[model samples]
Target chain A: MYKYNDFDEAFVRERVAQFRGQVERRIDGSLTEDEFKPLRLMNGLYLQLHAYMLRVAVPYGTLNSKQMDMLAHLAETYDKGYGHFTTRQNIQYNWPELRDVPDMLSDLADVEMHAIQTSGNTIRNVTADHFAGAAADEVADPRPVAELLRQWSTDHPEFQFLPRKFKLAVTGAAADRAVIKAHDIGIRILERDGVRGYEILVGGGLGRTPMIGKVLHDFLPEADLLPFIEATVSVWNRLGRRDNKYKARIKITVHEHGIEEIRRLVDERFAEIRPTFNGVDQEVLREIEAQFAAPEFRTDGVDDYDIAYADNPLFRSWADTNLSEHRADGYAIVSISIKKHGATPGDATADQMRVMADLARKYGHDELRISHEQNVILPHVHKSDLPALYLALRAADLATANIGLASDIIACPGMDYCALATARSIPVAQEIATRFDELKIEHDIGALKIKISGCINACGHHHVGHIGILGLDRAGVENYQITLGGDHTETAAVGERAGPGFSADDIVPAIERLVLGYMDLRDSADETFIETYRRLGAVPFKDILYPKEAANAA
Target chain B: MARAFTPKVITSNLLLSGDAVWFTANDTWSGDIAEAEFLTDEAHAELRLLEANAQTGVMVGAYLADAKLGDAGPVPTHFREDFRTRGPSNYAHGKQVETNV
Candidate 1:
């Protein structure tokens, strides 16, 4: 993790002081509710149905043991001993009194953390691949750049207020684990010739409207990244839709004005601003890069990782699902699966947090990551440490061996806690996972990312899942709309809606029908759900999910 | 009519660190609210004050009001409507105060 510099420390301290003063003024009759509301929301505070909610940023979803301990302490001391981890790699506490919030922030600041830009129509937390520094296949660690952007965007003078909230994501690996295509600005680290740089993708986002980002720059030189990104956001900040709140994201702006025009504007702006950042931001980036240099590794380990691979069936299954190929020899990057059967997606209790903190200290060389897919990663576990790590994880219920299986769902809080939700998402996710587990057929079904969002904000990234389920309310009854063929990979696509919405009672069965339909149509078991969906389109799945009514036809 | 008015009620939480005092519609935070202080028209305020007394350490903030001030009972619905029409208007220290924008 990137440690805060002097500037960072001063900024957060000043922000906390400002908020404390604001709270005092609101209480003392100087500031009205409307004025204080936006101010409070900007600091990740919300006035929910029953009480006030405070969301704390877990930057890029990465947390160390000290940070996790602080979070656990806050939950135990202030809240109901539970905190909800969001899809955007943040944790939210549902209840915190107004007076206690300032104190809570002070506690968080002790650990180099604050809730700034976690809300409001500003650049929110800059997310990146959870496995950024640790991924064996990474061309470079994306976090240093993500960290640099975080500092630049955090309360930047001009972009303090905008049409709506903006999000940025970066990934260094070939696999798009960060779902870069579904962000306002998605930067993919690439190597051209012998030099490393970025392939900039812009205007991709999911909310009321969903878009697959367009490639803005084929190869953005490493030196020009910050200024170029600043140029793009400056352009979007000015021209993004302000008339309708629903159409305020960059996606709508790109759709309305076309990507070519956006590119032209960004280029023009980049030219103007490029000179100001000459060598300064690059120096800062160089400093950040030093902090993230790869850990030392021993080469005299495994000759062939097949001995243990052949002996254990469970390890074999786990190895297949939980491991990603590393560019390093005698080492593997492990994604410790947290999507246990019937558990809340992305949630880790205080005990679980402590266990993960311990595991990171032991096998992971004091490094831990939170995947955007709602799983944790211990990136640099040696091939020899696999069995021990697996056993420890299994004891904590962290090992379910279903990394991309049907039960490994990514779900938002939905009606359970969110005041903005239309229907329940957590229960639906639980039911689906439970249903699939009971059938004992998740393995048979193969890799399927079933993402569920409470509403159209797409916080759960329902728009870019292999199978997306969106929960909506029709009158008082809950309804679910299904979308298929979407992917959050190197080649991303916005999901196509399957059919008319299904009633809450009918949703699970409809999903089963769609999955079974895929099985029937697939060329072989080797073909994944997403692959088959892309090959055959929505016709087969849609027909199965929304079969013609026999009674009406009769 | 002095006959009776619906009680205005607001939903709020007790702060973790607040003065141990009772808030009154008369904009007073006093420590002298007792069960017997409930008179016919002053019943709602008196009851709320007593309730506030129980949560001594908790910070007292956010109150519902219908813009009506009398000894009449507080109507929760009217206060809820007022809260919706205008956000959490009053802040509490030792007393309720209408904040300025």
Candidate 2:
């Protein structure tokens, strides 16, 4: 984890003090609600449906055990003994009072973390693959570049308050766990002839309109990243729509004005901006790179791991489901499943937070990464420690053996807490997960992602789910519309909408029918739902979704 | 053709607490929508919204939501308003927590 320098520390402390004064002013009636709303939003505070919600950024989704403890402390002290981790890999306190926000911000600053740019029209959190450093396959850790982007974008005078919020994501692995293709700007670290560089994709997002990014530059040298990205954003900032809020995102800009024209303008801007950089960012990158150097690994722990696997079936199941291959010989990347059966997808209680922190300190490398899929990743855990870690997680009820399976659903906080939501997504997700668990066919179903969003905003990344559910408020009733065949990988595509929407009561049953239908449609047990969908089109699945309509048509 | 007037209530989140609040007949905010002043007339609803918005210290995001008088008082006509009144469905939190059921 990157420690804050003096400059970083001062910047956060000053912002906290500024927000404290702003809160006082709003309370005293010196600032009107209209005036205060944007000010609060800039500081990651929102007046949600229930109480004020504060979104704290986990920069590139990497934080230390000490920072994790501070989050637990804040949740216990100010919130309802729990915190909701969002799809953006950020943690949200759903019930912080306005007066207590300043204190919470102060607490966050103490851990070298702050809520800066977690919301508002500025660039939100810069996210990276949770397995950035530890993945078995990678060009380099994307966090150093992600951290550089964070420092550059934080309080950038020129880019602040653009037409709309901008999102950037990076991935080191070719597997694309970060969902980089669905971001405004997606950077994939690539190496050519032993020299490292980036594959930059621009104008990809999922909201009212979902898009997979176009290759802005297939191979941009590592040195040109800052200037190149700056130019791209600058072009969008100058030309993007301010007339309609929906049409304001860079994706739409790239859509309306073809990528070719945008490319020309970016090139023009890059020429002007590149000279001004003069390798200062490269120097900064070198320092950041040094910080991310792999921690010391010991290759002597083969016997203990082998013995534990042989002895325990319960731990074996969890290990098989949640652990990933690390580059280091004796180490494995552990994914702590927060999506317990029938529980809210990404929420962790204060006690659970403390337990995860303790486990990270005990078995993990004192580092934690939040995955975009709403799970916590211990990027470096020795294979020998798997059994004890599995037991601790099982005791906490965090050991659900359903990663990349049907039961591991990604759902947004729908109408329940969000002012923007049209219908309830959480309950629907809960019901679906519980149903699949009851069936016990989750492992057989295999590698299916069910993402649910309350509305078209796609906060839950519903557009990219193998089975996507979008909850809409239709004529004062909760109606869920399902989409099929969306893929969120190196080769990403938006899911197609299935026929008519199902009622909230009918959604889980409809999903059950669809998944069961896919079981028969699949070519073999080895073929995943997505592979089956690709091999044979969505007609078979559509038949399952709208069986009555199909019968009527027949 | 003109749209018909529907029943409405002035609603917003409280400034300090950030909890959902409805405007009452006494010009005060109430946490419970049951105590809200339901307006049948469009002009009156606009006037109440303006009144609520002007009290900057008291409210945030003040606006009128569609409502109808029911056994519980001003019940929400739209699902969004109904959801806001009840809070999130995940856990018993917010007004759902307050109900203590």
Candidate 3:
């Protein structure tokens, strides 16, 4: 995890002090809501339907045990007893008070974390693969580049007032766990001739207008990364639409002007700005790289893990589903499911947070990661400790053997908390998870991503799910529209809409029908929902989604 | 012709707590929607909204929401406003928790 240096610490403290004064001024009527709204949003505070929401950035989704404990403390002391881990790999406290937010920020700064740039038109928190350092297929750890971007983008005067909110994601692996294709700038680290470089994709986004990013650069040398990125953002900042918020994103800019024109403009800007960069970014990156060095691994035997897998069916089930192959031998990446059956997805209670913190401290080299799929990951867990870890997780109700299964749904805090939401997403996610668990066929369904967004903002990344449920207000009632055949991996594609929407009451059963229908439709169990949908096309899935239409046709 | 104006209530979130509050008949903010001054006339509703917006120190994002004169008092007609009146369906933490008290 990246620790705050003297400069970083001072900067954060000064920001907290500034926000505290702003809050006080707002209270004293010196600053009206109009004046204070932007200030508060800059500090990651928003007045939602019921309460103030504070979105705290977890840089590249990396955290230490101490930071995790502080998040738990924030949840327990200030607002509700749990925090919602968002799809951006940040945590949102939904019920923060206006008066207590500065103090909350101060508390966050204590652990080298702050909510800065988590909102607003500024470059949001730079996210990366949660399995960056520990994934088996990683070419390099992407966190160093992510950290470099964070430092470069934070309070960057030139890009702060961009046309719209910008997002950037980086991944070191070939498989797109970071969902790089759906970001404003998606960077994939690759090696050619033993020299590390980046494949830059520009203009991809997933909101109302979903677009797969186009290849801006085939390969840019590692040294030119920051300059290249700055040039790209600068070009977009100049040309991106300012008249309409809907069309303000770089994706729209690229779409309207065409990627060829955008690329030409970016090249022109890159030529202009390339000379000003004096290798300081490289120095900072080198420093940041040291901090993200992989932990010493234990090369011990996995006899205990084998014994537990052979003896205990529950352990085996959890190991099979929740564990990912680690880069090191006898090591496994443990994804702790916050989405327990019948529980709100992405919400970890303070107790659960503390338990995860303790587990990370004791067994995971004090490193923890918040995955975009709304799960906490101990990315460096040894296989020998799997039995004990599984037992502890089971005791804490975190051992839900459903990592990529139907129950592990990615849901946004929809109408339940968001002021922008049209319908409730949490309830839908909970119902689906509970129903799927009840059916005991989640494992059979296999590697299905069910993402739900409250509205068209795609905060839930609904467009990328194998089965996407978008909640909308149709005729003043909650209606859910289903989309099929979406994939958020290397083969990223926006899921196509199936047909008409389902009532809120009918949605869970509708999903159950779709998944059960998928089982029947698949040639074999090994073929996942996405593969089945792809092989057979949308006709069969469309029939499954609209059974009434199928029945009427028959 | 424009659509006929529905019954409405002036509502905003309290600046201090960020909880939803309705402009009551007594010219004070109330957490309960029942105490809200329901305006059947569009002109009166706009005036009430202006009054609510003027209380900058007390609240933020004041706007008129669709409501109806229910058996008890003014009730939210839209699901969004209803959610504001009660709370989120997922947890009993917001207005629902306070209302129980």
Say which candidate scores most in DockQ. 3
The positional error of residue A437 in candidate 1, measured at the CA in angstroms, is: 0.7
Off by over 4 Å in 2: B99-101
Note the Cα lDDT for every prediction shown: 0.77, 0.91, 0.93
Per-residue lDDT of model 3, residues B6-75, tens digit only: 8889888889988899999878999989889989998888887888788999889899888988888999
Candidate 3: where are CA atoms >4 Å away? Answer: B99-101
The sequence of per-residue lDDT tens digits that candidate 3 reaches over residues A36-98 is 988999999988999899999999999999999999999999977999999999999998888
Global Cα RMSD, each model: 7.8, 1.3, 1.0
Interface RMSD of 2: 1.1
TM-scores of chain A, one for each prediction:
0.95, 0.99, 0.99
lDDT of 2 by residue, A389-465 (tens): 88898888888888889878899988888878888899998999999999999989888999999999999999999
Model 1 TM-score on a 0 to 1 scale: 0.84
Docking class of 2: high
Predicted structure with the largest lDDT when compared to the true one: 3
**lDDT head-to-head 1 vs 2, winner:** 2
Q: Candidate 1's residue-wise lDDT over A424-487, tens digit each? A: 6877888888899898888999999999998888888888889999998776567898988888
Candidate 3 overall Cα lDDT vs. reference?
Answer: 0.93
Q: For model 1, what is the error of residue A233's alpha carbon versus the real structure, in angstroms, after optimal superposition?
A: 1.4
- Chain A only: give the TM-score of model 1: 0.95
